[model samples]
Target chain A: MLNAQVEPYQRLRENLSQRDRSLREKVMTLEEAASFVQDGMKVGIGGSTMSRTPMAMIWELVRQRRKNLSCSRAITSTDGDILFGSGVSDHIITSWFAQGILWGLSKVMRRHVEQGLARYEEWSHMAVGMRFRAGGMGVPFLPIRSMLGSDVMDQRPEAKQIDCPFTGEKLLLVPALNPDVALIHVQRCDAYGNAQIDGLQFMDIDLALAANRVILTTERIVSNDQIRRAPDQTKIPFFCVDAVVEVPYGSAPHECFGIYEPMLNHMEAYVAKVNSDPVEGMREYLERYFYEPKSWNEYLALIGMEEVLDASQKGRSIYND
Target chain B: MTDTTRYTAAEILAILSARQLKDGQVVFAGVGTPLLAATLAQRLRCPGLTILFEGGVVGAFVEPGKLPPSTNDQRCTKRANMVLGSADVLLLLQRGYVDIGFMGGAQIDQFGNLNSSFIGDPAAPKTRLPGTGGGNDISSLTNMIVAMKHEKRRFVEKVDFITSPGFIRGGTSRAESGLPAGGMFRVITELAIFGFDEKTRRMKVLALNPGVSRENVQDNTGFDLVFDEQIAITEPPTEHELETLRSIDPERMFI
Candidate 1:
């Protein structure tokens, strides 16, 4: 006897509105908000190759000397090799690491690997399978195809292949990686952390959904009603996001399309310097870009806006223009 | 003869340059020799042959002497026709967009199964190495799979592990899997070039480096040696090819 007029699933629909309300209130600056990442936490970052990384926050963390800050596990879809090469990361879970090529033969990441400064878990793309599956299922581990035939399995013996009783085919068992926090940079986000990622949404949705807490750093922050007007455009809804930060031109030096152009010539010079004398060059880069600056404004001042813009224009001429 | 005892890196570069390529053909460039092949293909054979990097840049144009240190070089973005995501690259590979795939290995068995994962034991690897990145997918899908490796003891009869499916358990099962449908195509070494039998996909010596003997080639490989009726020496590099290769990547001589 179902009550004809009574709605049984009213609570579920009502809960959606409340969740949306919570998302509209929490917003801050990237520097002000990243402090939420406490010591001994596992953090996931969103980007692929060199696109869409929270470069500003990464530089800020380096500037703060957030050394050995107690983060045990670091995960990303692509190896943010430059971040690792800069000495901020300790343990990494990724397929490959490189500066200009694969595996950081450019000396930035090579020096770290050669010197044993960082520990890493090298897996094939199947590792992404484990993470994404865990994020979707809300589970901690999943069985995957055996990559044991490759060098990855030999390097990380713990990620071994065991015989499946049902099929007898060897399957590699991977531990699910659900990060405590995930920091994502996007094109636009509302004050409540409803984010819109325009192009090539590289693992951001999976990462946003997988993390227990989500911090979004966006180039622009729009009003709540503007987000609600086109709800489908929001790739990450308010329910999944914990905080939002407004960061104009956030992915500087690496380009964010309409926001900033890539600085190719400067990037080339940096790459050359890093490749030749990594330790000294990295120290100089940190001093010039991060440590010497007291605030984000000061850091911006160090690499003048005009110079960055000029570099961007030059890059556009070379690449896009 | 003493001067020709070892095939210099320049000779290897020249041999690669002589290979023919067509426009719009997609070539998957791996880290070392493949990189050289791509650069050579650009310089001599087919300037418009689309160069695909596993890192997801397509139709990349690296300057002759300005070879990037790694695949993720920002220069790739500046020089690329399109920048794709890693997953998209995998999709492209599966879709048969790539024509040729270049790969390298430490050990290769009689069947052409490559091992780049370990030198000693499976469970407890004494010396861990860089494992197959996307070589598995590239090997399976590319129209032709070209293997390039320096001839040595470490690369022998039975590989420690099969990193990429070359000619698995003969060729019947591989064809059954609906893989590119062709057998393994070519194995290029510093000393010579080897081609697989059309049906068996078994290695058959096709050519030798100048002054290199069949015995020396057999001694270096782990499998039983097969010799062709007329094994020709590879053509020596012209002055231009040698100059281009040396000018492009002088540092890689050590590797």
Candidate 2:
């Protein structure tokens, strides 16, 4: 006879496959996954600026018209910039702001900041990532020596100065960044959410496990067998993932390691487009590239899969030069 | 054959910065000129140089003919030995594993403190440049080598803001300030190379770049500089060095 009084919350914590459950139903459409994001939630994004960023997820969030979102991360690529430029995000916590010297995509954010339309608080990469690390470990704060002599200590509200208990040396403490949701883009992920990132984790793994909810977007979706075969490659276990979305070329214009190289020409065009006129240019860009596309397949069709495949070939070749 | 080549100031700066790197040294390099210099060193001078990028690539063997757009560009990890998180890179810096931290800045004060945070008051007003990325992490923990274009505006008596620690008041004050004991070692500019004096910890001329006079260096600098007993002229870039550097960055994106 089943015990009818077994509390659901208690049963969930005591589940047998707590860490190794089959989360097949966790897979959802990009729009559905994006619905998990609420307005005014502090969001953390994966990847360094212009490198393997979660562009598709960001676009979905913007398309959904989620407003008043604030970003938390070590650095952002076009992800944070586009969000702020499109009026999706109003504030950001980061260190680096420049787009790649090759592509000045973040010029929009700069314009917004200079105009006082958006706000930003800066921290060194170490101090910023350490906050995510502390959050993942369920700690209140993490100690470091990096921001000791920088202006970041004075600006960041969470950055505190504390004396070492034993050594009596002054150290900087970065508080944990417990974001409401974390959006991460990776190279491959299984339906059950055992994900693998090929190159430069760059705080993604930390951000994935740290946030209250993790919505993972991937370049491709693989089977559970493939994930089990190389469990060691999995950076995020299924238990940590709240939902997953499969979107090919998810980090377009930004390279997904071992898949495609960042398209410098496309990025340059983006910068030029926005730089010509920040407000009108972005609206036109978003309309043409994001709003018009009804689905992921349509977006890729617009991007032309041949160009992507060629770039992928070049990226895979170690010495293409 | 002795190769004689007339190089631009940027090219000359890259070569001079490359020459400072020792074989088998671990270098933490930022983007722009520093990237060009570190790659030049790896290809031309130090084959054993291990390059670390704050974006998480370690022991990166940057591909020729395709200069990475940023330190974290996919090309940086293409031939990397290990791809780590930014936190791991900082841990390595904290452990004192990185030998040379090559960087560039908008403003550098007499004490070598760099300011890339903002141009005007902290509250508001004026220009807001990109704040320090790994500037604080690298400058605070490693022996730093700065590369910048020499101008009176960039070389200031005191920076508007100390975005990253240099000498911190030009004395034991840096150590006294509870820092982990690492600061600037060399300042490579387009016109001349500068170093910190051991006694007073002030900017001192180490070498003058080709065709640049002592007065040219002084006129461009915002602060008074100390001079070594004998400052040598910086060596002109050889044809091989120029060709190698050009091959890496054919477009001269940052040069």
Candidate 3:
């Protein structure tokens, strides 16, 4: 059977189309990567809450003055606040939105949504993931067991309840959430864009495949040989990655797993200032942390070497002190 | 010796909630009181208990001085047994793997229904809180222990919105509404501990904290609280428990 089809297969092969599967370089500067994002696009942020959130890329987007972007994350955090505060993203779809889970609810997020400056949509953690799962699988929606008897379904009209054809039990269907751009931060990535995450992967893998484009901000860009040394650690392959930018401490002030812990002083200061006053506090913060810094290094300098080392030591658990 | 007599409301909440966790049970815990309670349980009582965080860290280890600010905090994963993806961990919570869910929310009703969604009317919310993350799924699938401050505003007659269903209007309603399993097992607060009456599923006092008057609990509660004829008085925190708790949180951030 294999040998007989060779003549007809060649003609069919010539008619078939393909995307570039070659190992081409996908490196780009943060500014260049930020260009791939546009207004009104559904931007998927990788990472949960504070850990490994792509704050640097988000900061760059605000600096570039992108507007009307719809953002989604498995769990939202202070980045959600920045998006609303800067008017970079007018809508946020997330499972949880807070500066820190223990810091109480975000007054910044509350002020924006309550005042009608932005729209906030909430989904159960499972529903958010299932939406991404459906998006990655190219399905319209996925069946869920939760949100069956709650106000969450009532709020989001997109979610529908139906009887399962197989089990004849009730199930809630959540629509696929395919973002226009997925911003993922990784522990390391090769220049060819095989990204590796050292700790909890969260939903970034599904998000990378579901989005139209994947832009990765990495803590370090290692060689392909280094990436290949432990191929299993590379959760997102080069094929899935469209662009990669190596920016050390990319998740600074937010923990990057084995790299560094959250810079508590920076976070606390921001939270205090913002809680005291929303508009002016956010504006001053944007100027100081996002806009005024000429370079990423300058921003890091503002965070200071002392806090950096301290956060790093805390993250690595290097000492008793 | 640590002063056990003057334990704060947070300390009492953690202590009471921690006591409910049994050994070898798999607990799905959120940040704040839940994590602290589970950690205290692991340290003081249930060493076999496996604590998992919402953001996919399974068998999460809680360092004494470093209680994470969020479930997804890197500290939650330092010595974790497995770091699954978001879907995988949430699936575990959905499929009956988790035994007890430890959580905190904005409001809870007489029937133990929780509201983390909004405070005032949905049409015009006076204060909008963070919406349900995994609160729905966790509450739907496993027994839950709620830890909250005992205030008139918090112990509401009815939640503004049901972000997590408890006994849904009491009785067999939650099950009749097509939920598989799980319901609120205990409601631990600073004033008293409550559990659902098996018949009515309404909040009934299981125990009262020492020195808190019966009128005080009823006065602080928005709804009429059901109290047993022989309500047990909660013992004050032991010297050891106080010392350990203080040691765990030297800065007293969550203590």
Candidate 4:
């Protein structure tokens, strides 16, 4: 369906002198990215646990009060928890819940699941990755050796046990998952969306390709020359990205690897807030941070850019060499 | 003040768990107490131990002072080895590349079956726990060592759900179920160390922790235990092991 068609929805980055039609034509504001998300849409999010999560887009979705989203990711932390807490997401398909900087259950997610406010389908981390891989490869299913002889096979409806065609060995088959839209945050990206992911790539590439649309939220927007300087660092190409939004400290409270350490104090405060009056505290938190800030710059300013600078400097110390 | 002489029950459990690790073996560790025990092993006795986090971090050299918040923590990939996607690391476990799979569970049965999935029925559950990440794959493929405190509530006749694959119904059932060969199951708790019988696959007590009598282990266990005739008293943590373990987790969050 993606023929040589250049739809009007494809808006190129503004202020660029050389206007190559082939140059990525989908650079939008975060609001525009979240607007594409309709009620009851299955949205795939890419990140490894808390690190490099698309917290900016997640907050934007929460701010817009998008409802009935089916959140899909392999390792979800604060991003998923916030979506569930804000009552924006009703269903989650994930392998595991990576709690905030302190490793434990996300109390919000736990309460939702236990209280039947939300539902979940569990998979092994690998199983979900394989599902994304199969989706990207345009395959029906991927064979794996996980969840065999365990209750995960019985628990997850999408997981099936089938004998290998070649060896007749029993292997678990995970069905392909194609998300309507993928919200991914990366370390750096050009205006055209040549993204670079530092540290662990996780399943970002697979999720990006598997989704019908990719909404790339980047930590910073760099020059095309910088992207070309290190082509090997690029994980997602321009064609795979449908929209690009520049969100500095986009994965706050969760580190962006070579950029910053996770803000543990912020995470602890979030836990404390949820612990004391889960409903009112969450609403106040959303109002104070997400609704109050007109722009990401305002949010960063409230969080103290000095701390961000310090964290960025600290993280750069070990990786800058 | 750091006490050099005595250690807490959790510290004692961690020390016992750490002692099970070999020097040069690769271990697949889950989060929380399992991570704590593996870190303690790396620091104290088994310096060459390579830790594998479920987030695809391999051969992580866990340094002291900062406890990794989760398996996906960037610290998990610090300093050494390769960072792979989550699928590739679990693939290694399936290939039998890992030696030991260290795990902790909410509930464990006499047959070594673990439950971290849910506390009640799957349909309309009472308590829904986070489902298995790679726990089942690790347990099925590697030599499984369980680390937890000895409590009547945690140890049961049968788990609410078997999140990790153990010897299914005893004798030859795991192999019969098409699970790949390699890896036996062992249980390491605060009060005792137990290993499954070769034939029956039933948990048998090998040693009891100091100050914990034979009756204490029996009282805490939900199922009947088979005690070895020459069951030895588990050695208390040395001054150095205790100091190093406490130093590793000075906050005592997991310990």
Best model per TM-score: 3
Identify the CAPRI category of the predicted complex in candidate 2: medium
For every model in order, the TM-score on chain A comes to 0.80, 0.89, 0.92, 0.89
Candidate-wise lDDT, in order: 0.60, 0.82, 0.85, 0.79
DockQ of 1: 0.21
Top lDDT hit: 3
lDDT of 4 at A223: 91
Q: For model 4, how does the per-residue alpha-carbon lDDT over B1-255 read when each residue is reduced to its tens digit?
A: 112358777788788888999999999998777888898988877878999998778888765666767787677776658888777788898788888999887788877888877888977677777677777778777789888877898989888887887886778877766686654567888788999998998889998888777888898889999998999987788989988888888887677
Quick one: how many clashes does candidate 3 have?
Answer: 0
- Runs with alpha carbons beyond 4 Å of true place in candidate 3: A1-21, A318-321, B1-5
What are the TM values for chain B, all candidates?
Answer: 0.87, 0.96, 0.95, 0.95
lDDT of 1 by residue, B89-156 (tens): 55576666777776655567666667654557745445444445566556656644454555666556
In the range A81-100, model 3's lDDT, one tens digit per residue, is 99999999999998778888
Candidates sorted by DockQ, descending order? 3, 2, 4, 1
lDDT of 2 by residue, A20-115 (tens): 445555889888898879999889988887777888888888888899997987776666668887788998988878666665335677678878
TM-score of each: 0.67, 0.93, 0.94, 0.91
Model 4, CA-based lDDT: 0.79
- Work out the iRMS of candidate 1: 5.7
True contacts kept of each: 0.15, 0.74, 0.76, 0.56
Q: Rank the candidates by TM-score, best first.
A: 3, 2, 4, 1
lDDT of 3 by residue, B45-94 (tens): 88888998888888876888877878887778756789899888989977
Ranking by lDDT: 3, 2, 4, 1
Q: Model 4: which residue pairs collide?
A: A11-A25
